[model samples]
Target chain A: MKLYGKFFLINLQSQMQYKVSFFLTIAGQFLASISTFLSLLFIFSRFPEIKGFTLNQVLLCFAVVQMAFSFAECFARGFDRFPSMISNGEFDRVMVRPRSAIFQIMAYKMEFARLGRFFQSLCMLIYAMIACGVFWSLSKLAVLFLMIICGSIIITGLFLVYAGLTFFTVEGLEFMNILTDGGREFGRYPFSVYGKEVLKFLTYVVPLALYQYYPLMYLLGKSDKILYGFLPPIGTLFILPCFAFWRFGLHRYKSTGS
Target chain B: MIEVSNLTKSFRVSTREAGFKNAVRALIKRKYEYIQALSGISFRIADGEMVGYIGPNGAGKSTTIKIMCGILTPDSGECEICGRIPWKERTRHVRDIGVVFGQRSQLWWDVPVIDSFELLRDIYKVEHSAYRKTLDELTQLLNLNRLLKTPTRNLSLGQRMRCEIAASLIHSPKVLFLDEPTIGLDAVSKIAVREFIKERNRNSGTTVILTTHDMQDIEALTERILLIGRGRILLDGNMRELKQRFSRHKKIAVAYAGSLSSDMLSNCDGITVREEKMGRALIVLDSNLLTVSEVIEMLSKTVDIKDISVEGVTAEEMVVELYKAYRI
Candidate 1:
């Protein structure tokens, strides 16, 4: 944790070096994400509800996924550039360190610029809370929080796998982007709206529904089993396989030329 | 302490022909050739001995270092460092060794040099007092007090190189493996780094293994040199011993008044006349077989010797000759 903080501070200082560029990127990110919000709004203008859920409920889903996505991207941007790290001889530097490779990679990069989308998503979450008619309980609130944390971990895990794939094929970047950006775009609506097949794929394959739909159902009073609320935290274990793959990739890294 | 026997590593490298179409075709149907990076190589270094691991490029220098530092595992080999296999016992093995990859740095680029050092101290779990003592010693020896506060990216090549060396030493490992530590540094920084390395090895009894293209580094830092070519140990012996074995040829520049008789070279045990042009004649005399004074006296008795100069084989030329012999 101490090392994480030091890394965070280093990244903060590095970003602050170019204040104008940082703010511009944040604003640009904010604008880019707002289009998704606007599209959801325009769709709801024609249809009063998405399946059984109202605009308010769907907005809440959108906000939760966005929050998780933004937070994960903010922290794990290091993995996003893993290919360049290998090509630029940075991986060799990473391997010699006494610390854990994951933490060091995480500490090496932090995407503060993505905070723009985070702020926009947060505001949507607050408005959805005011607009939605669902009653709030301490257990429900806890589940909501767990959902976001688990969602972040799952997405970060996907990013880790994406990076790990770079070990075998340096140019396989676009293929992994399907999971990262594709998951985020598909995540705008609750997994159920995509029908049973899509939800099953997300549940068993990527575990996107593990954090977004199943646990979320309990939080919104769709299910009575309180255990559902705890499932999101359990979903975080998806990173295990991803981390193992990363280790495997590291073993295969024939470090590039000097 | 280190023990190794019959270490070998091979890599399967994809081969490709030229042209964009060919590259695309390779993507579709690729052929791979196996590269024997290490071919049953074996050697042992007693603790505290500075062994210069020298090799031509692509001769598995980096591969061997990686294996020794626990970054790589050989296909079939036995390596025990400090009573532990490097790759099998990576965490424990790494605790006792420090690696400085010259082209790469262990320091975080955006962080100050001191911050990197402190992080290393924590990562290594060095006791606070011991960390402080080691930091002070390294800073004083490397003259790093001024460079500590600067972000690594802002420092010049020389400044950054000094910090790179310092970053690796913060843990005070028993063995220090330097892969081209003085590469691309200005002459001044090179000497400073050399002095600091020598001092660390002498005062602390830290084992230093340096791999560099600069032969001077071997001459100054290590008495023993291990030459590798084409994934094989071609020569491994003391520097003086290598010199005497390959020191049969020495250049003698002669300025004759007019002409020198061919019979003048006949009296010498083995004299190879390299070039005899104009008033000056250049001949290579076997120094190990005949003393320079004896050759000069013998040459003077037959021809008018205006001025004469004898040159011993430098490490640079000796290395070039060795490479030529190996054809690596």
Candidate 2:
């Protein structure tokens, strides 16, 4: 953790070297996210609810998924771009260090530009909270906070899975994005809206719905079952298999170049 | 101490022809061939020894280094460094070693050299006092006081290489693996790097394994040479033995005031007139067959010698001769 802090500081200092480019990227990220926000507005304007859920409820889902994604993108950007690290032989550098490869890679890069989407999501979250006025309670608030935190972990697991695939073939694997970026796109509304099959797949296979849909349902009072509120913690378990896959890939690692 | 025995590694490379039609066909039906990169190569280096690893391009120098460093695993063999198998105990084993690739920069390009060094300190978990002391020593020795504040991208190749050596040493590893550390360095910088490496080895007894195409590097630093070619260890011995085996000939250049007939020295055994000009004669003599002084005495009687110089064969020619002898 201390080394990660030092790496964070040095990477932040590196980004500061290009002040103009840094701000431009942040602005670009903000604008790119705004288009996604505008599409949500256009769809919500067409119908007051998506699958019987109000616009405010859907906005809340969108805000949580976006916040969690941006958080993962900001901190775990190294895994998201692991193929480049492999191709450029940076992973060999990580291997020579006396630390675990996963820690070194995790601390390798930090995309501060994702702060643009983070702030945008925070604003949407505030708007959704006010518009969807649920009675305040400590457990309700705890569940929402845990939902965001666990959602980031699940999303980070997806990034790790993506990075793990690079050891076999050091090329960008596009299909894995269906679970990462696609999760954020589909998580804008309740998973149930996607029908029974997509919900079951996300639940049993990827487990994106454990944190996003089931827990959010209990928080919104749509489900009286208290078990649903605690299910998000199980989503953190998804990282275990992802990490195991990473270790397996690491054993089969064939470094590029000489 | 490092011990490698019967280490072998092969890579499966996809093959295809160059034209567009062939490329399309390759996409449909790919053909692959396994290229044996290293085959049954083995050597052992005792602690605190500076050994030079020399080879032609793609002679498995880097492959051997990578396998020992735990970057690439070998197909079949054993490499134990400091009582640890590199690939099995990667984290523990790597803590005692440092590697520098001449074509690669371990320093973060956009960050100051000091930042990278500090990060390495934390990564290696060096205590504050130890880190400070090691940094101070390396900074002074490498003359990196000014370069540390500069971004790695802005430094010259020589300056960057100096810092690279420093970066790899921030942890003060027990064994240092330098792969062509002097490549592309200027004369002064090369001398500076070689001197620092010698000093570090002398002071701390850090084992140094260096690989390079530069014969001067081998001559100046390492007493032992390990030559690999076509993925096999061709020669393993100290400089003197290698010299004695391959460098059996000596060159004597004589500049005479008067014209000397080529037939005059031709009668001498084991002497060939390699070159002859208006007032100079270059003779190649096998030292085993005939002594330099004996040939000089024979030449002196034939001509009025202005100047005579005898030189032993250099390491450069010895390597070329070795390569030719092995037909690799």
Candidate 3:
């Protein structure tokens, strides 16, 4: 961990060398997500409610999922672009070092530019929270924060699985973007909005609903059941299989070039 | 200490033919070809032995190094480095070994050289005192004091090369594998690098296995040469023994004060006049048949010699001829 921190510090200092680019990308990340906010605005303007849920409540859902994705992509950029690392001989260096490959790869690169989308989505979320006018309790608030943090881990876990698959073949990486960028796109609305069959698939197959649908239902007062808030933590378990697959992929690695 | 037996590795490469149809068909139904990189290679190096691993291109030199360094696992082989299996116990096995690829730089490009060293110290979990001791030793030996403060990107190529060598030795590994360490280096830099390596090998008794195409490096540093061609060990013997065995012809360049008639030189036995058209008379005599002293005695009796020089065949020619002899 200490070595990883030092590497990250060095990388961060190097990245900060371009002050204008850093700040501009942060601003760009903010504006890019506004289009998603606008789409929600159009739908809510017509119906005023999405399946008995108000526009503000649905907007909050959109903001939380975007926030989770941007956070993971910001810190876990190493695994996000791991194919290039292997091709460029960085992974060989990682293997020879007397440290964990994952920790080193995490510190390989960081996409601080994603902070743009993070704050952009965050602004809409705050506006929606104010408009919803829900009185918050300590337990309800805990679940909301838990949902965001746990959702990031699940998403990062999926990225790890994607990176692990690179050990075999990197020819078909675009296929995985469906689960990553595509998941974030469709996740703008609550998983329940897609109906029971799709919701169950997200819950058991990919577990996107465990963090978004069930937890959002509890936070919105649609469910008085305290257990609804606990489903996000269960979603965190999805990382285990992702990690197991990574271990298997690592053993199968055959480095190329001199 | 390293040991290996019957090591093998092959790669599946996609084949492509020249045509638009083939290129389009490759996307739908790809044809793969297998290349046998290593074919039952076996060798054992005891501690403190500097072995030169030499070979032509695509002769499995890199594949052997990769397998030993735990980067690739062999198909059917037993390799033990200090009694530890490299691919199975990769982390533990690599802790005692250091590797240097001439083309790659392990140092961080933007950070100062010392900062990269510190990061390596943490990665290797070296004790503070030991790290300092080794750093000081390497700094003094490689003359890295001035370059340590400079970022790797700012340093000159020679300066960075010296620092790269230092970075590999910071942990005082037991074995070091150098892959073309002197490639593209200036004469002075190459000598300095060679001197530092010799110093390290002499003082620490670190087993060094260097792979290079420069015959001078093999002649200067290593005693045993393992020459591989076409994924097989073509020759494995001492440098001196190969020199004595395959050095078929001896060179004799004579500068005579008086020109002799061609009839007298043609009558001499066990001599081949390699160059008669040149200003100086040159003769090639079989070393196995006649001694240099006997040839000089015979020539001096008949021809008035002003100066004469004796030379032997270089290692490069001997290796080329050896490869040809085996039809590799």
Candidate 4:
């Protein structure tokens, strides 16, 4: 943990070297997410209810998914940039170190620019809480916290899987974005809005609905079963297989030219 | 201690002609050819031995270093360092070793060299006191005090290289692998690097495996050399032995007032007159068979000698001969 803190500080220092570029990138990221938020607003203004869920409820869902995505984008930037690491032989340096490769790669890069999207999502989340009529209770707060943590884990797992695939293919598989970026886009609305087929796919295959739609339903009083509120922790189990895939990929890792 | 036997590694790389249509065709049906990077290579280095690994490009020098560094696993081999197989027990084995790939920068590019060093200290879990002690020693020995505050990208190649060496040694590893460490450096920087390496090896008894294209690095730093060509060990011997074996011939240039007679070269067995013009003659002689005095004596007896100088074969020529002998 101390090592991680030192890495964080070093990365912060490195990023601070280019003050203008750093602020510009953060502003760019903020505007990028803001555009997505505006698109959401336009859709909500046209039709306030998305499959029986009001605009405010959908905004709450969008805020949660956006927050999770931005957090993963910040902390898990290494996996997102895995292909360039492999191509440039940075991965070899990771292998020679005594530390775990994943830890080193994660520490080597920290996307502070993603904080722009994070704050944007935080604002939307607050506005949603005010606009939506759900009462603020301790249990509801706990479930909401669990939803964000579990959601970050799921997205991070997807990034890991994406990184693992680089070991096999020469180029990064761009179609994987349909699951990652597409997940965030589709997640702006509750899974039910996409119909039952999409909800089942997200639950059993990707497990996005387990932490997002199911517990969200319980929090919104659509369901009274507390079991629904506890499903996010179970959804974190997806990380195991993603890690297993990474280990397998490590074996087949053919390093690039020296 | 490091031991490697029968190590072999092959890579299957896709091959295609360069053209618009060919690239398009490759997308549909790519073909790959297997390249044998290391073929049954074998060697052993005892603790504290500095072995210079020399080879032509694509002759498996970097591949062997990569395998030994635990960055790449071989297809079939037995390699053990400090009683641990490098690839199988990577974390445990790598803790005792440091590797510097010359073409790559291990330090964080945008941060100060000291920041990178501190992060490395934490990653390697060095005690604070030990880290401080080692950093002080390195800073003194490598003259890194001035370069510490500079970002790696801003430092010159020589300066960055010094910090690179320091970064690797911050953990006080038992073994160090340097691939082309002196490449693209000026003479002063090269000498500094070589001196630092020799000092480290002498002081700590740390084993060093160096791969470089600079023959001077081999001649100046390492006593023993391992020559590889075409993925196989071609020669393994000490510097003196290799020198005598491949560089016994010396070139002798004699300037005389008059041209030499043809009979002057007839009786000379080991000496070949390479050039004779304008009262000067250049002769090649095998010094092992015929001494320089003998050649000069043989020449002076026939032609009046004004000035004579003999040149022994250089380390650079010996390397050429070695490469020629191996046909790589």
What is the per-residue lDDT of model 4 for residues A1-258, given as tens digits with 9 covering 90 to 100?
Answer: 788888899889889999999999999989999999999889878886778998889889999999888888888878878999999999999999998888887877999988989999999999998888999799998999899999999988998899999999957488899888898988998988888898899999999998899999988899999999999999999999999999999888889866
Runs of candidate 2 with Cα error greater than 4 angstroms are B263-269, B301-303
> What does the lDDT read for residue B72 in candidate 1?
75
Off by over 4 Å in 4: B254-257, B260-269, B272-282, B287-290, B301-307
lDDT of 2 by residue, A1-258 (tens): 877888888888899899999999898888888899899889989888888898888888889899889998888978986899888888888999999988888888899888889988999988997788776589888888888999999999999999999888764499998899899988888999999999999999999999999988887889989899898899899999999999899887878766
Give the C-alpha lDDT of model 4: 0.90
lDDT of 3 by residue, B1-328 (tens): 8998889888878899989999999999999999999888888899998999988778899889988988888888899998999888988988989988888888988888998999888888889999999999999989998999898999887888899888888888999999899988898888898998888888999999999988887888888999887777777889999988877688899988656555666666667887765447888888877889998898888778888999887878877887788777
Q: Is candidate 2 or candidate 4 better by DockQ?
A: 4
Model 1 RMSD in angstroms: 2.5
- Model 2 docking category: medium
Q: What's the distance in Å from true for residue A159, model 3?
A: 1.5
A1-258 per-residue lDDT for model 3 (tens digits): 677788877887667777898888887877778877888889888997877778888888888898888888887878977998888877887887777788888888888888889888778778777777767788877988898899999998899999999998878999889888888998888988878899889999999998998888888888888898999889999999999999999877877766
Cα lDDT computed for each candidate against the true fold: 0.85, 0.90, 0.86, 0.90
CA displacement after TM-score superposition, residue A91 of candidate 4 (Å): 1.3
Question: TM-score for all predictions?
Answer: 0.93, 0.95, 0.92, 0.95
lDDT score of residue B174 within candidate 3: 93
Candidate 4: C-alpha RMSD to true structure equals: 2.0
Deviation in Å, model 3, residue A199 alpha carbon: 3.3
